[model samples]
Structure formats: structure tokens, C-alpha cells
Target: MKRSKQWDVRGAVGFAAFFHFLYSCATGCLLPFLTLYLRHLGLTAVMTGTIMAVKHLVALAWRPLSCILARRHNKRRTVITGSLVCSAAVALTLLLFPPTGNSTENKSCNISQLNNVPTTLRPRTTLQKFSPSVRYSAEHTINPIQKHNSTEYISAVPVNISTLHNNQSTAETTTSSRSDGKNSSDVQKPSAGKRSRSLMKREQKQEKITKIQYQFLESLKVMDTQQQMFFFIMMIMILWEILAAPLTWAADDGLHEYLDFVDATERHRAVKPWKLLGAAGGIGCSGILVSVLYCLIGTVLHFYAYALLMGLAVPLAALLPLYRHKREHVPGAGVKALQLVRGDSQAMLCAITAVLTGMAGSAVSDFLLWQLQDHNATELQMGIIMAVVPLCQAAFAPLNGCLSRLLKFHGRLLPLAILGLSLQCLSYSFLQTPWTILPSQVLAGISIGALWWSLEAQSADIASPGTELAVKRVFEGLYLDLGAGLGSVAGGFVVQKFGINTLFQGTAAVLGLWCVTLAMLQWRIPRQRRINYSRLLAADASEMSESESEQDNDWLEKAMEEDKGNNNWRRLD
Candidate 1:
């Protein structure tokens, strides 16, 4: 029986890590480059922000359904279906809308040229400078070679007009002979008026064509392309949300539930939440690192093959969860929606923290990309610079976890995470060169790793028995989504107005203030009053006698056997 429990634990954690890695890999490949891609397509910063914000805005409506699906059906099946759908939608989007250098400008200009200008009305100022012989030859007696090369007429007419001007006395003699007693000035005046009128008409035509081109370029930069691209992106984002939300929600709830179960089975606290969360973070970091490499190589080479390969990674990683082993199921699903009204201080804190984290994290990509462009970093250097955050995260997360285990302190790490967040913002704000990006990324890794592990475990511990754990998880997810959306839009405006460095400075200031406030509040709260998983799960921690324990184990096994055949999901009241 103990062996069976151990196997379940190993399988669950391993599968969870695999799922996170694949999800992150697919997401990393596309999302980090999404804003840059849209800009490349000629969308302005404001438009890009609005479009990116929509990606997260969908989560507001979608997150609740994720909880419902996870609770009301087989989570494994739900995860698989979601993974497949998300994979297909994302793959189609990238493949169909592959990037082309200068395609946007070329397309816009082509349309303008077709609609706004006439082919025959070439701007002809140079013709007035031609001498009589050359001008006559150019206009009336074209050589076969000159006819073959139409461009020669332009240069020939200009030089001949200049020569004709130099021989003005001969031109006057010729004109006087033709005039035959009529005043030459009188004959030439009307012709001069006609020439002036013709030049004026030509100039007006040229100005009109220039005006049309300018308007087309402006429209391409600011408005309509963004609208078209927004709708296109929304189609993909909606499909992605429909699938990814449920699977991710289920995984989050499952991991937390598994932790509770582990606590119930072990007499002593053997599996810590920090270690579990850190491992997940580590896997995510590795996935992002690989994703950045692929994105850089593909983008620089201007090929979709590398990105498509990354998109294909989604389902491959998803298959791990479908391994035909007995999955650990946590019993009881009730009205967790009711707990939303309970207004627990701890839950509120967790939700607020998630929002801040989302705000800080979501816009970091845009800022980093902006910095790379400003500094003129190469594609490979940009990829490595972008990858620094995840690498640092992977290194520090488990280190923090191991430290937590050794120090026997979990709540204490929350402040450290906040500190890391503050430092990251400062680093991004001040650092100008590629070399400086690494230090900031190290801070980011620590901040993100610590916050995710500690905040989640803390949120779960505060929930009462009647609460739906899935709902609790979804609440955090929703806040994060909201924050990210708002941040992306706001960051776009900030970058447009004050530049990327200012955005980083403002972010740092906001986070530093938050860190100080969180530290002060944390200082006031007693350690025992705060969350501890062991204490929280210890309600079912009572020891049974040897014979009773055997009977309980036998009953649990029989119940599991019965449940194997009846896999109906429970609904919350």
C-alpha cells in the first residue's frame, strides 16, 4: 500500500512537471515575440499594446470555466483535450501568418500606387533645360537604342534644353523668321502661359500622389492594420484560452491537492510545498531557455521551421500526463464559489500579490526587446539576454527550496521574493548594455520562483473545508491575467511616451513600495497565525492503531476499486 502511494506521488509530480514544461515551451516560443512581430507588421506601440492586452483579457471570462471543467469531469481527459486544441490553434496561427521582411510597407505602397497614381504622368522638370536639336530629337526623333532604353530620354532632354538655352540668339532668329512680321514677344507670350499652366498641372499631380502615399503609410502605422490584426489574433487567442485555461487550472489544483494527500499519508512532513513548487519552476525555466534559443534562431534566419517545431512540443509534453497509471484523486467538491464571499484576508493578499507579479512580469519582455533594439544587440545576443531571466529562475528556485527545507522557514521567503522583484525592476531600469541584463534576470528568477511557490501554498492553507480548491486556484489565475493585460497596455503607452527605461524605473519604484509595505505587514503577523501546510493539513493527521490502520487502508483500496468504474464528476452547489 505504501509502495502504491509512493508510485502515485512520483507519477503525479513527474507528469505535472512535464505538462508545465511543454505549456511554457509553446507559450515562450510565441508570446515573447508576439509584440515584436506585430510591430514588424507595422502596428504602432499603442495598437500593439491593445492587441497584447486582449490576450490576457480573455482569461477573465475563461478562468471560471476552467475550474468548472476540472471539477465536473476527468481532469486528465480535460487536460489532454485542452492541450490538443491549444496546440492546433497556435500552430495554425504561426504557420498562416509567417513574418516577411518589409512585407507590410510593400503591401501598403503597392495598394496606394495602384489606386492613386497614373503611369504616364512622369514628373518632367528636366525637359525645360534641353537645347533645340536634342529636345527635338528626344521628343520627336527617338533612336532605336534610346527607344529600347526609355530612361535615356529623360537625361537627353535635360542636356539638349540646356544647350538650346545657351544658343538663344539663333533660337530668336528662327522664331522671328517663322513669325513673319508679327511681334515674336506676342507669339511667345501665349506659348509661355501654356507652358506655365502645363508645369503647374504636373506639380499638382505629383503633390497629390505624394499626399496619397503619406496617408496610406499613416493608416498602416496607426489604425486599420491593428484592427485587422487584432481580430485575427483574437481568433487564435480565444481558441488558445478555451483549451489552455482548463488544463492549467486542473494542473494547479491537482498539484496542491496532491500535496495535501501526501501530508495526510506521511506521519511526518516529508514532501514540502517549496520543493514541489521549485521543481515545477525549474522545469518551466528550462523550457523557456530552449524556447528563446529557437525563437532567436528562427527569427534571425527568417524561417518558421524552428517556431513550428516549438509549437509541436505542446502535445508531446502533454502526453506524459496520459500515462496509464492510477492518478491520485482528492475527494469532495462543494460550493467553492461561496468562499469567494468569505473575504479571507490571506486569500485577498494572495490575489493582490498575483496581480502585482503579473503587472511586473508581463511587460518585461517588451522592455527587454526595446532595450535590445536600442543597444543594437544581435539576434543570438538578444536570445541569450532574454533567456537570462529563466536561467536565473531555474538556478535560484530549487536553491531557495533547498534552503527552505534546511532553514525550516517558508513565510520568511516571501519578503525575499519581493526583494528580488524590486531588485529586478531596478536592474532593468538602470542597465544599458547586454552584459548588465544578467544580474537583473538573476533577480527576476529569485523573485518569480519564490513568489509562485510561497504565495500558492499560503493561499491554499487559508481555505476552509467547504471551499473548492479549484476556485481558489482560479482566483489567483484571474488576478494574474487581469494584471498582465493592464500592464501590457499601460506599458505600451509608457514606452511610447517616456521610453522603455522609464517604464522599468517606474516598475521598480512601484515594486519597491510594495515590498516595503508587504514587509511591514508581514512583520506584524505572528508566524503561527500565518500559513503552515503541516499545521493546516494536520486536522486529518490523527494516528490510528495498527489494526484500525489496516482496516482503513483496506476500505480505501476497496473504494478506489469501485471508483475505477465510476468516473463521474461532482458539481458544486
Candidate 2:
């Protein structure tokens, strides 16, 4: 059922929130566990790093193309289509590479194979002299027989018998001695047998060890093949991200337009666009929660369930078209959109914010799971801890928005969020237990939630009227993606070389510097130039009132024209 165009605003918001939630779910499910998954498939750290880097590189490359397409076509349609495509790619990858067996099962199976190797040895008594023929026969019996015809063996046997007879006289004294000592030899035989049995056990153990190593090598070959397939699947996912990212931002623009429409109509006087944006954070938070739930369930149950649930975003996003609207023709919209999509002070700031956020986020993502696992945290524990971040973000986002409005500090929220991020890094650097680390994620959540809301609002505030906010969003997404991608690449090397602790410390230091830089920059900007929500609300209200009055006049004129036409038609009849 299609709703009226005025109700499209609500639909647009709903679709945007749902899509954002799904995107979060997909990324959260895959990215947090990606390193572990690659390692399981026997990919070296370097290979893993390369794969991660390539994914971002592909996504970064696609941003420009996606941006152009979003600008030239239907943003909402593009978003919906991209969502479906990315979802399919995720599902295909999951199907191609089924979840690996548990570590314990692989270990136990290898051990059992080694344990089945049998002992292969016999006891030997006294150092009694042997004729050459007897020695050769004994040696031949102990060793593996060569494959040959019966005739050849028979001929050799005759020669061996002749030689034995020739040496028979020489062996006579030795034989007599052996017969005389037989009684004593029998007395000591049991002891010799005991020693030989111990030796045989040792040999069996060694043989088992060798077999295990061989099995391990064979397993390595399988792992390599699995890794290659995994790489291919990940590549497809990255390519999909490249196409999907800009489409997502385009949806952001559509929501912006819808908000503007609501304001002009004065349908919901109490609700503001920024508040709605903040509330939308819940959608993304739900995604994070869902991914975390999958992680927990995967640990306890079958992993296939997790893979399926992670991809639920696709079907949820397919409904975006129901909320879509035709592009409203605004004067100079194209040129303004292009300008905002390009470079400007606001864009640069967004890029800086995104890069710094990415760098910090990369370091955290690389190490958090590892740290938890190292501390012997169970999968369920880790999942809960991981979910805390998004949960906090979800809870705090609306609060931050309200705070921004109440305090009239539009730009200050970012600095506070940065500080929260810095605290998270510091806590990770020092915290010993994985459980203790959970509290620190609240800071991260706050940082992330506030940063997102503030950046989006700030970006919109700076753009000119009639400019599609999606263009600015595209640039924002590009820089954010670039920053995060590059951060992950560097983080891999850092974690490999210096250890996880150092990665956290380094991230904290870097974020600290960024916070300082941001503070200084904000200080230099005059108070009058800073964005005030109060002033913005006043401006929007005046503009909307003027537009509404003009619209009312036009409606009255159109009604009069229709009535006049009806009267003329009746008179003619």
C-alpha cells in the first residue's frame, strides 16, 4: 500500500533507518570476525592484510562512480538496488565457503589418526655369530621384499644354500658353543624381550609423531585452497560495498529532502530533523545488536544461522522504493550538488574526522577480539562485549542530539566524542581483563554516536540551499571509507610487528593529537560563524512560512481557474 506523498517523509525515515541498520548488521557480522576467519583458512597475516586493504581500495575506487550515478539518477532507487545486490553477494559468499570445523574437532581428529599407528618391532637375543648366508637371510626377512618373479628368487636361494654349506664347517664351533649356551640364553631371554618391548613402544611413538606431522602438512594444502576461495568471496563483497556505499549516502540526501518537506508543511511541529537523525541511530544500533547476537549464537549453535541473519539487511532494504519520490526540480540544484560533492572546508573537516575515526577504529577492531581471546574470554563473553559499543551508541545518540539542541553547541559535540574515543583507546591500552574492557566501549559508543550526528548535521548546515545533501554525504563517505581502509591496512602491520598493546597506545596518542587539533581549529572560528540550532530553526521557520503562504495563494488561484473552466463548459452545453 502506497501512502500519500506527504507521508513519504515518514516512510523515507523508516527506510533510511532500516537500511542503515542492515548495513551495520552486515558489516559488524563480517568485519569483527574477518581476521580470525582468514587465519582459520590458513592465510598468512600478510595475505589477510592484503585482502583487507584491497577491499577498501575497491570501495574507495567505486565511491566516485557511485556518486556520479546517484547524482544523475534516482538516489532512492539506486540505494534500494545496491542494497539488494550487496545482500546477494554476501549470501553467495557465505554459501560458497561454509563455516569451518571447530578447533577442538580438528585437533582431536588429527591426534586419533596418529594414535592408530601400530608398533612394528621384534626382540633379539645374544650376539651369536652368523654365517653370511644366515645373516643375509635375516636381513632380507627384516626388510621389505623386492618384487620379482619366483624363478629369480629360486635361483638366488640355490646359491645361498651352496654358500651356507661352504661355511658350514666354519660355523660348527660357533654352533656347538651356541648349543652349550642355550640353557643360559633361555634364562636371560625374558629380560631381553622386556627391553625390546620398551624399544618397540618408543619407535611406535616416534612413528605416530611423524604420521601426525604428515597429516598436518596435508591439512595445510586444504587450508590454502580454502583461503583462496575465501579471498575471492571477500573480493566480491568489497566490490559490492563500493557500489552500495554511495547509494546509502544518497538515501541520506533523500531523507534530508523529506525532512525539509515536513518542516515546510509543519505537520509535526515538535519533531526536528536532527532529532530524527539521532533516533535513527537506533536502527544501526539494532544491527550491531543483531550481529552480536549472531556471534553469540554461532558460538553455541551452528554458524550457518549467523551467516543468514547477518544478511537480513538485503530484504529489509528492498522496501526502500516504496518510500522513494521523484526528484523535485530546484533551480541550480545540479551545480550546487556538484560543488558540495567536490572539495570545500566542510568536506575537508569531514574527511579529517573520518580519517581519524577510521584510524582509531581500525586499531580497535584489529586488537579487541584478539585481546579478548588472549584473556581466555569465551565466545559468548566476547559477543556481549562487542555489542556494548553499538548499544551505547544507540542509547546515547538521541541524547547527544537533545544535548546539542539544549546546549546550542552544534560543533562542540564532536570534540567531546573525540575525547570519548581517546578514553576508549586509553582504557584498552591499560585494561587487563576482557570483561573490564566492556565498560570502555561506552566511551567508544558515545564517541561514535555523537560524531556521526554532529558530522552529518554540520555537513548539512554548511551546504547551500537546493544542493542535494547526498552529494556532501558522498564526499563524507569517501573520506570516511578511505580513512578506515587505510587505517586497517596500517593496523595489520602494526599489530603484526609491535603487538596489540602498542597498537592501542599508538591509536590513543594519535587520537589525542587529533582532538587537540580539532579544539584549536574550533577556537579560531568566531562564535558568530559557528552553527546554532536556535538560529537555524528560526531561519527554517521563516522560510517555510513564506513558502507555505505562496503555496496557499497558488492553490486558491488554481481552484478559481478550474471553477471558471467548469462554468464555461456548462454555458456552452
What's each prediction's clash count? Answer: 8, 0
What TM-score, over all chains together, does every model reach?
Answer: 0.58, 0.59
**Candidate 1 TM-score, true structure as reference:** 0.58
- Reference-based lDDT, residue 402, model 1: 73
For TM-score, the strongest prediction is 2
Model 2, residue 451: C-alpha shift (Å): 2.0
Winner by lDDT? 2
Residues 1-573 of candidate 1 have per-residue lDDT tens digits of: 355424366656656665556555545545565566565544556767776677688776676666656555656555655565555556456434422112211111233443454533321211223455443232334434334532323332112232333366456756866876656445677786896688567656765665665554434333232354555666776676665566555555545555555553221122233333333343344334434443222232222432443455555544443322145343344335335523565455556767886887777765567576567555445555565566655655446447656755455676677778877877777766777787676677667767766765565556555354554554455446888888889888898898888888888788788878877776675553545677665645256467876888999999997786465433321
Query: Candidate 1: where is the Cα deviation over 4 Å?
Result: 1-12, 70-79, 94-223, 251-342, 400-411, 465-475, 524-573
lDDT of each: 0.56, 0.57
In angstroms, the error of model 1 at 22 is 3.4
| lDDT score for residue 334 of model 1 | 31
Instruction: Summarize candidate 2's per-residue lDDT along 292-327 as a digit string, tens digits.
Output: 443222221222333454356556655652323355
Stretches of candidate 2 exceeding 4 Å from the true structure: 1-12, 15-23, 67-86, 89-234, 240-247, 250-303, 310-318, 321-350, 406-408, 471-475, 525-573
